[model samples]
Target chain A: AKSVSISVEGMTCSSCVQSIEQHLGKMNGIHNIKVSLEDKNAVVIYDSKLQTPVTLQEAICDMGFDATLAD
Target chain B: LQKHEFFVDMTCEGCSNAVTRVLHRLGGVNFDIDLPNKKVYIDSEHNVDTLLETLKKTGKNASYLGEKSAQ
Candidate 1:
């Protein structure tokens, strides 16, 4: 498994954190996820063959938050 | 069913929830939001203009992205 970190914008409260984590977790290939509302970022560990940064970003978008690969 | 698409500028879960709330109020509509792409897809019997107006009422700048109706 490979790990990737992403920067997110406009997350407020624990509910936001939970929502993002829960939605992304439902996607296949996502093995682990850590979202920090304070830092406005998420670290995800997943199967490299099954997911990509773009797909991860899409999952975040699906939950209604802006996300991009962390620089 | 008709498929309508819109581009909405949303930054967080709260914004998405707002969108969902408005869509639900529209009645006979179900939606899928694509946050990174800033888009929302709706399956409904309503026309595009009503959906566009409803999204704007959420205080987020939104635009119609066309519509497709399934036979």
Candidate 2:
């Protein structure tokens, strides 16, 4: 598995963090996810052959937050 | 433009903000977020499917509550 950290914007509460975690957690390639509202980012672990950092970032973006890959 | 009523599972300011951002990003849409009621009323040229799909992108549970008015 590969891990990626994505910077997320516009979340205001713990519910926001939970929502992202719940939604992305159900995806096919994702193994685990941790969303931090305080840190304004999501760290995701996934199958490298099945997902890319860009795809993860875009998935978060599609969920209405401004998401970008974090080095 | 037509007004459509949608029920989105919004629990707090963050949820409502997510709704706001997605609708705004879709463009050509004017909307009101009733966070307490978990309702979103959108005035747009987009079809019901398009609007609903857009709302679902927020990773919230969203359902169409039918049309409201023609404005």
Candidate 3:
């Protein structure tokens, strides 16, 4: 598994954080997720073969938050 | 433009924020989010399917509740 950090925005509270984690967690490749509302970022661990930084970022973006892979 | 009512399972401010962002990102929408009621009323030129798809991006269960008369 590989860990990636994604910058997330527009989260105003814990519910936003939980939604990102819950949605991403259900995906096939994602193994773990931690969303920080104060930090405005998500750290995700996933199977390298099944997911990529871009895909992880896009998954979160798909959930309506602005997400980008951290450099 | 038509007014559409939709049910979104928004439980908190963050959930509502996600709705606001997705609709704003999709553009051509003027929406009102009622978090307490888990409802969203939107005025838009987009089709119901498109709007529902956009709302679902928030990772919330969203379904169209039919159109509302334009005021």
Candidate 4:
């Protein structure tokens, strides 16, 4: 599993956190996910062979959120 | 009884889209959404409490910023 972290903007409460999580959780090959509203970031674990950071970013975008892969 | 504004936590264009989608799903309520400002204006005659709870269930935090009489 490959782990990647991305910064997210505009999360104000726990519900916002839950929304992002619910959307991302539906994607295939996503092993685990954690989102912090206070920190404005999300960490995702996935299979590199089956998925990539770009794919994750697109998923986030599709759900109406911004995500940039952490350096 | 009135219109209200909320400062929504949205990250990008996608986030705005998601917020709009959720609000639109609520039957019989009208919403004026501003993506750039991350805000929503709702006009409804239904119970505000029900509306607020629906927003929360969709992963958005909404605060009552008072109301204005319908013009």
TM-score of chain B of each: 0.86, 0.92, 0.91, 0.69
Interface RMSD of each: 8.0, 1.1, 1.7, 6.0
- Model 4, B1-71: lDDT tens digits are 56866666655554565666556656677877776776667887667776666555434455666575656
Per-residue alpha-carbon lDDT of model 3 for A17-50, expressed as tens digits? 8888888989998889999998899999999999
The lDDT for every candidate, in the order shown, is 0.78, 0.91, 0.86, 0.70
**Higher-lDDT candidate of 3 and 4:** 3
lDDT tens per residue, model 2, B1-71: 55799999999888898899888889999898899999999988899899999999998999999978755
Q: Tell me the tens digit of each residue's lDDT in model 1 across B1-71.
A: 76787899777667777578667766898889887788898887787888788777555579987875745
lDDT, candidate 4, residue B3? 82
Could you give the candidate ranking by lDDT, starting with the highest?
Answer: 2, 3, 1, 4
Could you tell me the fnat of model 1? 0.11
> Which residue runs does candidate 2 get wrong by more than 4 Å?
none
* DockQ in order: 0.11, 0.80, 0.67, 0.16
* Candidate 1, residue B31: lDDT: 84
Off by over 4 Å in 3: none
B25, model 3: CA deviation in Å?
2.7
Candidate with the greatest TM-score versus the true structure: 2
Please tell me which predicted candidate would have the highest DockQ against the true structure.
Answer: 2
Give the CA lDDT, 0 to 100, for residue B39 in model 3.
Answer: 88
